[model samples]
Target: MYTKKNYTIKRMLSWTRRYIFMFILLSTIPVVLYEVLDWKWLHLPWLPIGLVGTALAFIIGFKNNASYGRLWEARKIYGGIVNASRLLATMVNDFITNEYALKDRTDAEFFEIKKSMIMRHVAWMTALRHTLRVKKPWETTTNNKSDQEVMKKLHIQEYAFTLEEELKDYLSKEEKQAVLSKTNKQTAVLNLQSKAIKELKLDGLIDDFRHVEFKNMIGELFTLQGKAERIKNFPYPRQFATLNLFFAWIFVALLPFGLMSEFEKIGETLNGSNHTGILFQFISENFVWLTIPFSVVISWIFFTMERIGDVSENPFEGIANDVPITTISRGIEIDIREMIGDDKNEIPKPHPEYEHTQM
Candidate 1:
C-alpha cells in the first residue's frame, strides 16, 4: 500500500503520538510523587529489575517479528491481485472477436451483447477491486469519450450514477484499505462478472475458444480470492503473542528494582544532606516513573508498531498507507466501458492525487 519504500517511518511517527503521550504521562506521575514525598527505599536489590528488563526486551522483539510476518503476507496477496487484474484485462481483449460480432444476432442484439458483456466485465474488475478495498462504486464510463451514441447504447449514464450513490454508502474506509493489500476486492468483482461469461457461453455468444480463455482467467481470479481470504481470516497464531507480551510485561515491571540499589548506595554516600536528599528524593521519587512508565513507553512502542503493521499488510483497509480500492474499481469501470465501446466521458476521471494514495 505504501508505494514509498521507507514510508513506514512517517506512518510510525503519526500513529504513535498518542501512545507516546500516554506513556510519558504514566511515567511522569511517579517521578513527581516520589520527589514530593522525599521517601527512602531501605533494602530492595536491583538485580531482579535488570533481569526483568532483559527478558521483556526479548519478548517484545518476538512480538514485533510476528506482527511483521502477518503484514508481509497481506502484501503478497495484493501482488497476486495486480497480476490477476492485468491478466483479466488482457483476456477481455483476447476473447471477443469479429466472428461473434458478425453473427445471426441482429445488429442491435450483436452490439448490445458485445457492449453489455464487455462493460460488465469492466464493472466486475472495478467492483472486485473496490470490494476488496471496500470502496464505493462509480459510474461506468470509458475514459473521457463521452458521446450520445455510447450513452444511449449502454444505458450507463442513468444507471451508473445510481450504483455509484449506493456504493458510496456501502464502502467503509478501513475495509477498503485493508482489502487493497490482498487484492481481494478485484477478485470478488471478477467472481460476479464470471456469471456474465457463463451466460454468454450458454447463449452461444462466445465460442469454445473464447470460453476456454475466459475460464482460465476465472481460475486465476478465484485463486487470488482464496489466498486473500486465508490471510484475512487466519493471521499469525495469537498464542505466541500472548505469551511473549505477558513475559515482557513482567520483566519490564521489575527492571528498576535492580537499578534501585545503585541509586540508593549513591544516596547513602552523600550522607543524607538536605540538599543531596532533595536530589535523591527527586531521583527516587519517580522509581515507578523511571521503570514502570519507561517500560510502558517501550511496551507501547512495540505494540503500536504491531498494530500499524497489522493494518498495513492488508492495505485495502484504508489505513494511512492503504491501497485505494474505490479508485481502482472506478478505473476498472472506466477501462472496461471503453473497451466494450461504451465511451461516455461522463464517467469520472482518476484523480492523480488519489491515484498514488489508494491503499
Candidate 2:
C-alpha cells in the first residue's frame, strides 16, 4: 500500500521512534548498573539469548507469512470483482433487447432499463464495500492506539460518509428503503438485482438464455463477496499473534543484558593491550557504552517486523494499507456508467489519494 519507491529514513523513524525510546531506556539500565554501580551479576550469557532469538525469528517469520497470505487473498478477491463487474456491465448493455419483448417499447425505454440495471449494480458494489469496512471487534486498525494515531494522518473511504447517503445515489427511494430495512444490506441488493433481471426476462426484454447467463454472473458476484467476507470475518489465530508479541519482547528485554558484556569484553581486550595513542585509549574505554544504541537498534528491528505483520493481517479494515476496495468500487462505477453512455460529470471521480496511497 505504501507506493513510494522507498520509505525515507525519516518516515521509518517516525513509525518506530516511540519503540526506539523504550528500547534505549530498557538497554541503558543494565549498562549503568554494570559500569557505575559495579553490578557484575547483571549480565546474561549470549547462548540462551541466541537460542531465544532464533526461536523468535521463526515465530515472526510464520506470522508475517500468514499475514501476507490474508492480505494477498483479499486483493485477489477484489481483482475478481473488478473483472466480473466489467463483464456484468457489458452483458447488461448487450444481452437485453427489444426483439422478443412481450409489449412494444421505444429505444429510450430500453436505455432506461439498461441504466436502471447498471445503477443497481453500482448499488450492490456500494453496499458490499460498506459492509466490508464495518469495524470488527478484532480489527487492530480501530482497536489499537498506535495504529489509530497512524490512521489519523490518512483517509479511509468508509469513514467519509454514512452508507444511507451514498446508497441514495444508486437506488430508487423504495429500493433504498427496502435495503435499509434489511440486516444484510449487500445480500438484499443482490436479491433485488435478481428479481429485476427476472422481471426483464418475463417481459421478454431478455430472452431465456440471456436470463440464465445474467443469473450466473450474479452467482459469481456472490461468490466473490463471500470470499471477501470470509477473510474479514475470520481472523488469524490469536494465540500465535498474542504470544509472538510476548516472545519478541522477552528477547528484547534480555538482549542488552547479553550484549553489554560482549561489548565490554571487546573494550577490555582493547585496553589490556597497549594502545598507540590517547585517542585510541579513550575509544577503548568508552566502547562498552555503545551497546545502548546497538541494543536499541537491534530490538527495534524485531519489534517493527512483528508490528508490520500485526497490521498487515487485515486488509479491509478501511486503513490506508488496506486493499483499496473503495477506490476499486468507484472505478467500476465509472466504467459501468460510461459503458452506458452516462456523462463524465455524472460518473463519480476516483477516490482521492491520501499520503500517496489511495484507499
List ranges where model 2 is wrong by over 4 Å: 1-7, 355-359
Of the candidates shown, which would achieve the greatest TM-score relative to the real structure?
Answer: 2
Clashes of each: 34, 0
TM accuracy, model 1:
0.61
Candidate 2, 206-254: lDDT as tens digits = 9989999999999998999899899989998999999999999999999
- Which segments of candidate 1 are over 4 A away from where they belong? 1-14, 25-39, 42-51, 100-115, 122-192, 202-205, 244-252, 255-300, 309-315, 331-344, 351-359
TM-score of each: 0.61, 0.95
Judged by whole-model lDDT over C-alpha atoms, candidate 2 comes out at 0.87
lDDT of 1 by residue, 1-359 (tens): 76564564564555456555655554444444444454544224656655665665676566656655655565666566556655665565555545654345665565565555555455444444434433222111222122112233332222344434433333345433433445445554455467668877776667878888888877876776676556545545557555754664454344333333454456455545555566566665433434455446565755564444334444443433444445545565566556545547645576344322311
Best by lDDT: 2
